[model samples]
Target chain A: MLAKRIVPCLDIKDGKTVKGINFVNFRDAGDPVELGAQYSREGADELVYLDITASHEGRKTFTELVKKVAANISIPFTVGGGINELKDVDRLLSAGADKVSINSAALRNPKLIEDIAKNFGSQVCVVAIDANYENNDWICYLNGGRIPTEKHLFQWAAEAESLGAGEILFTSMTHDGVKDGYANEALATLAENLHIPIIASGGAGKMEHFRDTFTLGKADAALAASVFHFGEIGIRDLKHYLREEGINVRL
Target chain B: MDVAIVKYNAGNIYSVNYALKRLGIEATITADPELLNKADKVIFPGVGEAETTMNYLKEQKLDVIIKNLKQPVLGICLGMQLMCRYSEEGDVNCLGIFDTDVKRFIPQKHEDKVPHMGWNTITQVKDGLFNAELENQFVYFVHSYYVPVNEFTAATTEYIHPFSASLHKDNFYATQFHPEKSGSVGEIILNNFLKL
Candidate 1:
């Protein structure tokens, strides 16, 4: 049986991790590489590094950070942010990233997804979408949830899958930092419609939240940040709880 | 010396190269027959349509060159399938390095997914690339087609049915799983191959 993944996301800025209160009032956590290794030992199924800074200096720092993280951690890692072209994908992959996630870039040039998938295989390409409920419909957001797009969540997800996305990482902007729970309504919609694996992101406050996302939302994986980073919940304990709830997890 | 990884329209060669580097061994990716033949060891990795891959190998005359290699050779995933006599994928004939046939896994019910994509434990039947250290370790696998268990089967894993997880004959070694993506256990397997 396939194990339901538990991922710890790190927001990297200028080569260091920055944790915040509601994606603002940021504070330094720790070294990205060391934190990645710690999470791996704690039984994280995989890790995601989102480069929050796309400035010229930040780009160089992010590349080095990826190399350092890859050298330390043995588990599969996905890198996102500033991935606009095929060359960007190649650069990160060569730096030891197992997969590259594209978001705003894909919207600008949908052909980029097809090209990368054709050259490197769909298994290595992931499409990350930040969505929010507006006007009684789920709408897509870009630039780390700062910009809005007219594209509906379901339509974009289906298009991404058809364009050869191996997986879809959907983050609910409304429930992101609230930690009340996942946007089950949005996740359920995407999971029910998409053939590719759907990773539910944002609003993971408690261990039961993960269970609810997997059971109710039917997500393939649940991704969280502060919950796993700040020691509020350990990955091993989370998996133990999920397993107790009859969820299939890697022990 | 760097090992040569055959780069002829194959899948997952970069991962193989990265795995070798993790084990502190350098590797070169090449499609040139002369370059591949002269390397200390050779690896052929693939993940694609069988008939098209076989045709590419035939056109390049690499099928003969690969079979004639004197050094240790490793084939992964589709690369291993191409070494077999024939594959049901697109009804293609292969290099015939191993006396076997590759068959697609047919699910009795609709629930069974075509691609068996995840980690499964292996039961070592005979020592080959794994030695005694990896008798019952789990390796990552992602494929729809598999080679039936046979004399060349060095390790066995069960999915819908028991299938060959690893195969070896003479200097040839192959695995249906992606060792490069299998974490530390996979690194050890690559180290064993490098030492061989």
Candidate 2:
């Protein structure tokens, strides 16, 4: 049986780790490599390092950071943000990323997904969709949820799968940093619509939120940031709680 | 000595290269047959549609080079699938290094997800690739097709049904999961492979 994954996302800026509330008012977390190793020790199934400043800086430091983190940790780590071309993907992979997540890049050039998938294989390529509910419909957001696109969430997800994206990382903007929980309604729709694994991100104040995301949202993985970072919930205890709740977790 | 990772339009080559570096081994990624043959060891790692992968391998003549290699070789995920005799994915024929076929994990009921993604425990370990003390350990897996348990199966895992988690034959070793991502137990496996 495959165990449900518990992921802790690290937001990176200028080679340093930072966390923000609703994508602003950032606070320094720590060195990415150090935090990564700590998370690995704490039993995080995987780690996602998003270079939040990559786009603004017009260059990505994730490659170098991945090299640093991969040296100390054995768990799978995914790097994203400012990944626009095959060379960028190649550089990150060469530097030690197990997977590369593409968001704005995929929206800007849909063909890039197919190209990367063709060159590196789909399983190594992940298309992360930042979604928001507006006007009673799921809309795709770009530029770290600062800009909204006309493309519908389900449509872009299906398109991404067709283009050979191995998995979809869906983050709900509405519930982001709110700690109310993941947007279960939107996640369930994605799970039902896509054949690939869905990673539900954003929200998650408590352990019950994770349970709701997995049970109601039907997500393969639940990704959170602040809760795990601040020690609000330990991964071991959370997994034990989930296991008691009848969720299949690797103990 | 630099390890060579065959880079013929496959998946997860970099992760394997990083894994080698962690084990204190330098690695080079190359599709060049000469560089590959010159390396201390060769690794083939992939994730994708089998037919297209096979086509790419054929185009680069990697199919022949991989089979003729003298050094120890490791394959992961789709790389393992491609090493087999055949794969149901896109109905593609494979390298035939192992006398097994990759088949879809057809769920008898609707609950079975096509892609079996996440961690599962390994049992019946038989190869030196895994530390003897680490039997029945859990490893992460993400794939839609699986190689059925057979004579080459070094380790096995049970999902809806039992399947090969790792397969080993003379000079050839393959894993359905990403050892590079499987944490300490996985590192032990990689270390064992390097020592071999």
Candidate 3:
């Protein structure tokens, strides 16, 4: 049986982790390698390192950090943020990152998705969509949901799948950071519409929310940041909870 | 001990090299037949299309070198698929190291994903690369095509149906899942392969 995945996304800035994590055993909590190892020890199925750095030097540092993380962590990890072209994907993948996620770059040029799938195989391309619900419609957003786009969420997601996107990372801007839950209704629609795997993001506050996203949202995986970093919920305990609820989780 | 990873045009060999590094082994990633033939262990790891990769392997003569390897050889994902007798991916024949055929996964239900991309548990563990402790252990897998359960199957995983998660025949061993990306359980499997 394929276990529903639990991924903890870490924000990276200038090669270091941006958010303050609450793990006390670490020498430096900001080290992405250490944090990634800790998460792996705590039963995270995968990790996502989103480089939030703006400078070119910082991107180089992020690449080095990716090498360190890959050398230390055994599980799969994806690198995202500021990945605009094939060279960026090649740089990160050559540095040992398993996959790369593209967002605004993909929206800016949908052809980038086809290029990635063609050059690196479809398994390496993860299309991340940031969408906000407005006027009773899910509207796609750019630049981390600050700027709205004309593309509808479902239409763009379907188009991305057709463009050879191996997976879709859907983040609901309206539900993010609210601790309410995932947008299960919208997620179910995407899952039903697309053949590729769907990774549900943006609203995960508790273990039950994880269960809801897997069962109701039909998400193949669920990604969260603060809850796992701040020790609000432990991954082992969450997997156990999900297991008891009859969800197939890697325990 | 010298370890070599056969590198052709496929990707994801870096992850396998890093995984071996975590195990305290600095493996040489090369396509040179001399280095590959001299190494104590050869890892054939890949993540790409089977037809193009097979063509590249034949062009580089890595296919013949891999088939003649007497030392323990491990194949992963596309490497594993290419080791089979045939693949439905590109309507191409493989290296015929394993007496099996790779078939494309068809979605039986609305939820049966094509890639089968996630952590999955393996059952019916056997000797070569699997132990009793490794039974029912979860490992990461990401592939669209799979080799159905066969005589050489060392372990099986259930996705759409029972399929060969790993196969073993003499010195050649293959895994459909990425043992390097499968966390601690994967570490155990890789260690087992190295130990062989």
Q: How far does residue B100 in candidate 2 sit from its true spot (Å)?
A: 1.7
In the range B1-196, model 3's lDDT, one tens digit per residue, is 8999998877878889888988999999999989999999999998989899889899898889999999999999999999999999889888999988999998899889888898999999899999999999999999999999999999999989999999999999999999999888999989998898
Off by over 4 Å in 1: B1-4, B7-11, B26-41, B47-61, B86-92, B99-126, B130-137, B142-164, B192-196
Off by over 4 Å in 3: A19-29
The model with the greatest TM-score is 3
lDDT of residue A169 for candidate 2? 95
lDDT of each: 0.84, 0.86, 0.90
Candidate 1 per-residue lDDT, tens place, A130-200, comes to 88888898889878777898888899989998998878899888888888899887888777776667889
Residues A1-251, candidate 2: write the lDDT tens digits.
77889999999888887888887788877878888888887788989999887554435455667778877788888889888899989888878777899999899899999998778777678899998888999899889988999899999999999998988999988899999999998899888887778999989999999999999999989999988878788988999999999998876
Model 3 chain A weakest lDDT span, ten residues long = A20-29
Model 1 lDDT, residue A153, Cα? 88
Please name the candidate that would achieve the greatest DockQ relative to the true structure: 3
Give lDDT: candidate 1, residue A208: 89
DockQ-superior candidate, 1 or 2:
2
Local error of candidate 1 at B122, Å? 3.9
